[model samples]
Target chain A: MQTLDQERTSAPPKQIEDLSLLGEVSHRTAGVSRLEMCIQCGCCGGSCPSEADMDHTPRMLFAMLRAGMRHAALMSNTPWICVSCYHCVVRCPQNVHIADVMYTLKSMAIEAKLYQDSTAPDFSQTFVDMVEEFGRSFELGLATRHYLKHFPLRLPNMAPMGIGMLSKQRMNITPTRIKGIAQLKAVLKRAKEVEAAS
Target chain B: MNKYILYPGCSMESSARAYYDSLKAITDIIGLNLQEIEDWNCCGATEYLGIKLTPAYALISRNLALAAQQADGTRTVVAPCSACYLNLAKADYYMQEQPVLGQHVNEALAAGGLSYKPGSLDIRHLLDVLVYDVGLDTIKSKVVRPLTGLRVAPYLGCMVPRPDYEHRWSDYEYPVELDRLLNALGADVIEFPLKTECCGGHMTQISPDTAFELIRRLVSAADEHQADLMATLCPMCQMNLDAYQSETNKFFHTSYRMPVIFFTQLMGLAFGLEAKDLGFGLELVSARNALAKIGIEHPAEIPTGTARPKKDGSLPMPAPLPRRNMHTEKGKVVK
Candidate 1:
């Protein structure tokens, strides 16, 4: 896995126009239009709480999308780093849904198999797995699997908090399945089929 | 009694048990009748929607579909978790606004022999329903302990107020509903300038340094204002600010233990509910010092401003930038 530094220094992939990322995304979802409306304003970046940690600021990512650098934008840590705080979306002068655009990039990234940096993506998948398994989340299980996978070293530091929570009866060790888990799974399976059909 | 459906997103069961417990306790006092949506799944949170749209929306909308089935003329569905509430409301609003998306989502719902018409259910955040539906004055009437001595900085985080399709929040940038609600509890509500600021959300898990910067901004700002504690409405915000505070402090070489508790938890406390029942000790940063204020006679007034002159001559926070009115010409935003 390339470190964030490597990811940042990595060149924008030879400006390939095999597909216009922005155009493809807009075509897929009509909910977005203001992509063409971005004034290249720095509102999204400036308002982003985690922009400094991102490989590309939201503004730069948008510019890359407009420039059709799909590979570069998709591989960047920008989309993965977004916490969906939505500060930028509401603050955008042009009313561009910056958060939604990040969502689009994440979907595109997953579809194209471009997310080589795996910590955040893995965390997301772990979360989904927990939910999918029981219909409700299992935090202790999710945290153990996640930290032991991506961040074993930090586990010791996090143990005290975990212990505190456990002592307080805050951490439920058992995974509780929703009564309609079968129905939820069916809906999810069908949703995937619908997505694939589209 | 105000009746509505409650979708206690997964976190309410495990990580935010305090929130779930306190919300349950407060509702009884406020006369809110919440019908739990039978067998609701996760709301897909902030993670799933980014990974896949249809399935994620379906996962969230399935809950909506189920709520619609059980609405029985009470169409409102309230979620206490900000992310769950946002996802549910977004699914409902976007499905109504876009036909193709709605059709695709409903197609998925059909497999489970369930279907939800767009706008069939009223999706709302718990804070919205409490402040708007319950009314502050009515809440004020029930506050047995009046929280007079405890000074709280009302932190709304980012989700509850923004992209409000229902036009419920008073203002997107600087919503005063939380402040008003806390005031109705008779707590001294500090005029927190960063009330609507991002609480770094899941960045605490993904990038610790980035999350610390955001957390520090909120915690230190509250500390600077001499707030006894910081109260928020979102489970995500409480976890980030309260649980990760010391980690943030360790990273930034600063020491701050600004107690971040859920607003509903505070509400339960003011309604004369037991602190243990409100899940007070679950917070990594203890609110005991702040809560202990309840024991002493209530202070009539506590001054809020620069606690003392900054010896190093640090300037006060800059005036907030004026919002750009969207109706103006393209070039109207001055650099």
Candidate 2:
């Protein structure tokens, strides 16, 4: 796996047409119109709780889009810290739909295989594994697997927390899969079709 | 009479059974028909969409499509689980927001011989329906056993209110619909600051300490408010607060036995429904003791002290506003 640093240095500037991935999905989704409504106001940036942590604020991102600086927008850590709080959309004076735009941007980045993060993919994978196996998110299993996947050496560290949760009967160690896994698989298939068509 | 397609999710059948039972009982009493979507799948909850966006959303959207197909006329889809509600709403919102994602997901759906028309259904959290459709007046009327003496801290969690696509909730940071519902039930609702705080969701599994710390803040705040119990609409919040209270205490080396019950369960009790029938006893942190404090021995009997206003009509009303001087120093008359 190439580090984000390596990808940053080696990757060429992403062209605006590369954003077509977003257009494909955003077309059928209200997210596109929401993105179009962005007036480059700083409400989304100003309202973000974790704005300090982001390399580009939501406003700057829109500004980048308007300026056609696709590569800079795609490579920033702004999308990762969004927290998906629709506060930006709620607070925007011009009704700029910030959250959907952020999601589209994130999707575009992921599809381009740029701006790789160590934790997000593992977190996403853990979620899929749980659903595929049990037709739902097994909290304990997901937590344990996520920690194990991300921090292999921290296996023993989870004991204190695990025991703490276990004693309270919060951590159900026994895996409980839904009755029919085929139904979940079918759902996955259907969603993929939606992803493709849009 | 509002009819909706119900997506009970997995927790409603297992961990949060009381939510399902009480919602059913109350909706029935209110004359609302909740038709369950046939062959509904898991919502991917808090974790799946994070792992693989396409499949995670697909998994959730598949259920929405099924609910929409199953909808006779009503376009609203109601989910009791906060994670389920958020996932369903998020998928629907995103599919419309990102056409490429919509295309990809639709293509995936086509493979399964199922396609979803975006925006076909309005996804609503259970609390939204209770507050909006079944107004407080109607809820107030059904109070056979008022929770007058009981004090409850309403917990909304992070998912339900935020990113509220349908505008179902109040301010994301401090929603009061649950508190309003409880107050209408005659319970002393506490003003909790961490009402919309994260219950660590699935973070408890990935980072126990982080989850514990978050849970501790919520539980501790409720305890500080002298709340008799914590009322929640989200199963994940209920699970973390109820099932993990003892563990959180152990981690912090403190003791807390606060019972976490579904808001619907408390409503069921207030509605004079059977306590056992509402699955009150099924909770890991039993609410039986709390129920006893309100003079509710069993669900059948109307608890004492829950009577309506006396014939004399002498009930506490809001204090009348103090008379204001008509003229100001500048000789401007206040309207």
DockQ winner = 1
Return the TM-score for candidate 2, rounded to 2 decimals: 0.72
Among all candidates shown, the one with the greatest lDDT? 1
lDDT for position A22 in model 1: 72
Interface RMSD of each: 6.6, 7.8
- Across A1-198, the per-residue lDDT of candidate 2 in tens digits comes to 333455456645457575453344334234444555667768788776556546778877676565555666777777666665566766788776566566566666666666746465457566667767777656577667777777776656546545544543444667566654675677676665555543
Per-residue lDDT of model 1, residues A54-163, tens digit only: 77888887777776666677788888888787888888899887787788788888888898577887778888888887888787898899889877998877776777
Clash number for every model?
0, 48
Candidate 2 lDDT over B1-335, as tens digits, reads 77888899877765676778778777877667888988777786654543346776677777877787778988999888887888788778767876666777776666556789888889998889888998899999989989988989989877788778767777877888998999999998998887877676655554455567668888888889988899999888887787667677866778988888889888888888878777665566567677788887633322222235577768777976764332353365532
TM-score of every model versus the real structure: 0.88, 0.72
The C-alpha RMSD of each candidate to the native structure, in angstroms, is 9.6, 13.5
Candidate 2 deviant stretches above 4 angstroms? A1-30, A33-85, A92-120, A147-198, B25-27, B51-54, B93-104, B170-173, B207-213, B246-257, B281-289, B297-335
Q: How good is the docking of model 2, by CAPRI class?
A: acceptable
